[model samples]
Target: MPTITLSVKDENFAGKVLQEVLIGFHSETVTIRDIIEARVLQEVEAYNQKQPQYFNGLVQPADAEKTVNGYQLRNKVVIDPEKQVYVALDAFQKNGFFVLVDTLQCSSLNDKVRLHADTRISFIKLTPLVGG
Candidate 1:
């Protein structure tokens, strides 16, 4: 079993550390999409287990708003995990965010790459200018 650290960051490069996940690799390579899906699924499971009334996901959960800490606590866990994953992948494809594997930028979901014990994966979310 190999483990990887998943992190989310903003434009200024500040990051939020996510949990490390143990993954099984058939060999020494896996697709980017596979990695993303695994991450999203793990997040969803954690959120579900915590049983938060609201779900704090890669993006804001539906019908929920951010709090002072920027997390939404909903009274009902009513969001689709699969849909959330799809939205994230779509966002990646549209440049809504970027993936950095071990400090190297990954450009495609289908791109295959090798994993290492110390590999740190970062999701850098880009924000758009209000006036632009």
Candidate 2:
């Protein structure tokens, strides 16, 4: 089983780690969409088992006025993991976030990339300006 590390980044490169999951790939490559899906599912499972303090993914901060660190929801909101993943994916399609595979930027969701034993995948969330 190979493992991939997820890291979240803002404007700065000093990113915070989101999670790590062991994924089984049929071949030496996998699609960007599949990678995102796996990452989201892992996050959802973690949230369901033991609710984390924060969620750093492709989401609009405006959805809830109150939040922790402007990413994690402040209120104890019940989230449908599948729905959240879909929302994130949709957002990605619209340039909501960016995916970097081992320091290389991935522009297309269907793009195939080779995997490594410890691949470092980073997600950079783009925040919209207020009243812009």
Candidate 3:
């Protein structure tokens, strides 16, 4: 019924889980955790291109210690397979622009879905109200 897409700067990584994550929307409840897990798996696979086993379980401190795309991943990251929804918001202070990821609509575990590679994102607009 609904579709979910994950767009990444890395084309190869996004292609890995594009089908799986899109298929998760067939049901009524989509879990963002699963989607994130799939992405992480892709990242791990990319990191361990020589050995596939490096991405099997939770990423330990030693795993996070490595660098990826010039960025260092921290051990504080948690991979929870049981989590179902994700609400993410990003704001650009300089440009006054914001984006929100609606985990409820774009999850694969909930309805018929599709995945795409696009940089454009949609978000709801909210205005702060003054209250005493």
Candidate 4:
């Protein structure tokens, strides 16, 4: 299948998109696991190229501080895509965040998602309420 570019965003519970990027997928159909992996890889590659102090991806890195834009690593180091993918997958499984393919909510890591040229995917991180 021809590669398709889709819009990916990190959103908040208030429906505000904090960050956005366009990613190209080689296939139109992919599992949630695949999506996380690809997205992580792209984010890592971009960060690696720039060697930025903040990592703006699906999940935070080890010993990193969570900032408004992204995670601020303790040191300026190259992020491993595999580690990020692993953490992201675990986060999804543990309800740390949720994924939405267009308007459809994903239920499983193995769940299949259909992509279109205009499809938009959102990753919303779940923040715990301060007060009980």
Best by TM-score: 4
- Could you tell me which 10 consecutive residues in candidate 4 have the lowest summed lDDT? 123-132
Report residue 8 deviation for candidate 3 (angstroms).
3.6
Candidate 2 per-residue C-alpha lDDT over 29-112 given as tens digits, one digit per residue, 9 for 90 to 100: 888888777766655565557655665434432343425443455564655667766776777788777888788889898989
Q: In candidate 3, where is summed lDDT lowest over 10 consecutive residues? A: 84-93
Question: How high is the CA lDDT of each candidate model?
Answer: 0.62, 0.61, 0.30, 0.80
Clashing pairs in 2: none
Q: What is the lDDT of residue 102 in candidate 1?
A: 82
TM-score (all chains, Cα) for each model: 0.73, 0.67, 0.29, 0.89
Candidate 3, residues 89-119: lDDT per residue as tens digits?
1112211222223332232332332334442
**What does candidate 1's lDDT look like per residue over 2-109, in tens digits?**
444434333336656642344444445777787777766766777777766544445555656666454464455645678767877887788877878887889999
Candidate order (lDDT)? 4, 1, 2, 3
Error of 2 at 115 (Å): 0.5
Task: Give the higher-TM-score candidate: 1 or 3.
Answer: 1
Q: lDDT score of model 3?
A: 0.30
Name the regions of candidate 4 deviating beyond 4 angstroms. 127-132
Q: Please provide, for model 4 over 1-132, each residue's C-alpha lDDT reduced to its tens digit, 9 standing for 90 to 100.
A: 438888889889898998998787899899998888888888888998997867777767776788776788778887777777777888788888899998788979999988888887998889521100
